[model samples]
Target: MIQMDLEQRQSSRFVRPFQVTNHEDETFSAAFEGADVNLTGLGFFIDDPDLFLPQQRLSLRIKNEQTDEVYCLEGVEVIHLRPDDSGKYLCGCHISHVTSNQLLAHHRLVMTDAETALVSMETSKLSEFNFMEDGSELSTDESDFQEASMALNLAVSQSESNQQEVARFVQSVESIFASTQSSDMKLQDLKEEFEDFKQYLGQMNESTIAFATLAKLLAHTPAEPQDKLAWKTLISDFETRFLSEEQQVAYDFMHQGLDADEALEIAQEYLKK
Candidate 1:
């Protein structure tokens, strides 16, 4: 394992309220309490350091109690294993391989924790300065104290805003995943409903044409409400389940007046790579 002194740490570690489970070992306990997490790695106590070798990979599930956010990391490489005085080993590991979405969520979680720590640090620093004194020289200039307090308030507000945005993004991604699964389960029913509506529309158009060609040509008829609903559901289901990220971009480009052939060609090239 790569060893380093405490002063050589690359990222600031914080004790956030989150739980982690080691999927590799069933006998490992004390998982619900939480761990020390930073931007890059996690430090958790285990029963034995001898069980883990240098550079060993582990599967872990981390859940943040405050946010109720869960991240299941499939690949994490062990950086070091140290036995503490309590007889338990402190396992240090860094995330190695994870999907794009999971990585994004993990990064956001780390950022949220780091931002909270920073806000706390700034508040503590501001508290150290004596802004008001009873007929005595202030330890810090009043204007300077005001500016520092304002800056701290602004930082706290900005951090909360960023956290809300991250939560919304994660929620939307989860909703899409749920929608995709639900759509797949009802695909056959949706297809049948769409086909039935198409047949009915065709029959009505044929009759309208037979009655009077000119009237039919001039008519601006709206689709039935049920037909519109079915069509919308089918379209949403198709786009969500079948299209890849690259293909969806190409599809949007086609609707925006780009040449269909060019869009298809670009999408194909992306898929090939």
Candidate 2:
């Protein structure tokens, strides 16, 4: 366990008992024995050395446990009077104003025995429901069991869906690679027939059919470094052999149009393989 300073002084301040009632208007009043105190500048603090700011208006109600009387205080702002090295503050406040006999009635209600018993009973029941004993097993209600089962099934389904997507991507890459190989072989066969080869290259360039097919395939497959290197080499070789002076310009433009980041990603993926 982490150790902290245990020598620090700790004390509890017992204020005059009163009951409080909070209202929706971002205000709360404290009632005590038929008098209500309109409090302003109420806030909370901790023993840590960090500053705490209130997100909303501060208000509180104090109740007399012995008399069932309630007191309401409104419009209170908490001021950090003094802070220690550990960031703990000694806080104190004064009531800004008081109004109405309704506050006194509230104070009386809080100091009653019946009110004290009711509050104690509710607190005890809540503690019993929330508290866990040492070595005690967790208990699951029917709703909890159903939620667990649903979550398990959802996870299994998502796993299967991802697997299928990956398999489909792999298949697409293979198909495109096969088509490219076939086209390359055809180009090789027509090499001796210069005129025919030139014509074929022109058609290929005009259609951008092969590059388009490869691009689609690459889009589906995971981009690996090795795959990108191989692709670059293939394109370099094709450019060297079949690209005419004019076609080279078009090819350069098209290459530039492709996203460099995506190309690098494909290369990274190949490196992974």
Candidate 3:
């Protein structure tokens, strides 16, 4: 099986070594080096997730890793933040604006020997995982499609229709990409690819959605750090009660007499498909 990086964002992120020397904020002339974990002309993932706020805009000066090329991008929006295992935050931003020349320059600078090779290898794997290919990618044949359907069946054993639904979704994606492969590909192809993935993700089983949401929330939220705060809050009245599956699982776990930390861990795993 091809290894798939759970690309949680819409952009195709290239995760090779790169650096950004930035007065990432507007007010200071002084520059700081943020961890350039992944680079794309579209946006970047900066370190220190807590340092930036959601919906914030930044100005950055990015330096090329393999050469002296440097470029500046402004009005980059801090779209979302995810935490890595090392206790640092991956701050994702959107490149709201850039000139044509700057865009070309950034692309050229990032297409270094190491990054170029890394992108080519990863893109091949990603193409297999998605069941589509252009000349630049690895094609998934009919047998590969059958394997995928079988995998889907095993994954969502709760319902045969779930497997059928997902199989059809994948086939439609294959058709779209195959049709587009005959012509010269454009940025629109990228857009369509993401739309297809988003649609597939939306149609995922409840357990999968719940698991992904939990994965996202745990990576960012602080409420779990303290035993006093539950990831899900409880509000009870004389009349009615409201709680999510996560909340209910957590509540039951607590009632069974486990400590907060242990209960949280078990609840999270239980909700995952």
lDDT of 1 by residue, 1-273 (tens): 122333333365667777778775343354644557654467777786677777898888777777776777766778888877777888887655454334334544554543553543332211111111222222223433443333233334334444565565556555555565667655754565556656755544432222121111112111445433432342333234333455455555555555544554575677778
For candidate 3, write residues 14-77 as lDDT tens digits: 5544455455533324434344432232334445567778778777776655665566766466
Q: Candidate 1 — what's its lDDT? A: 0.49
lDDT of 2 by residue, 14-57 (tens): 23333334443223332212121211222233344243343333
- Candidates sorted on lDDT, descending: 1, 3, 2
Worst 10 residues of 1 by lDDT: 125-134
Give, for candidate 2, the lowest lDDT window spanning 10 residues: 124-133
TM-score of each model, in listed order: 0.36, 0.20, 0.33
Candidate 3: RMSD over Cα atoms?
A: 20.5
Query: In candidate 3, how many Å is residue 45 off?
Result: 6.8
Q: After superposition, which runs of candidate 2 have C-alpha atoms over 4 Å from their true positions?
A: 1-57, 83-88, 102-273
TM-score for predicted model 3 compared with the true structure? 0.33
How many backbone clashes does every candidate have? 0, 58, 0
Ranking according to TM-score, highest score first: 1, 3, 2
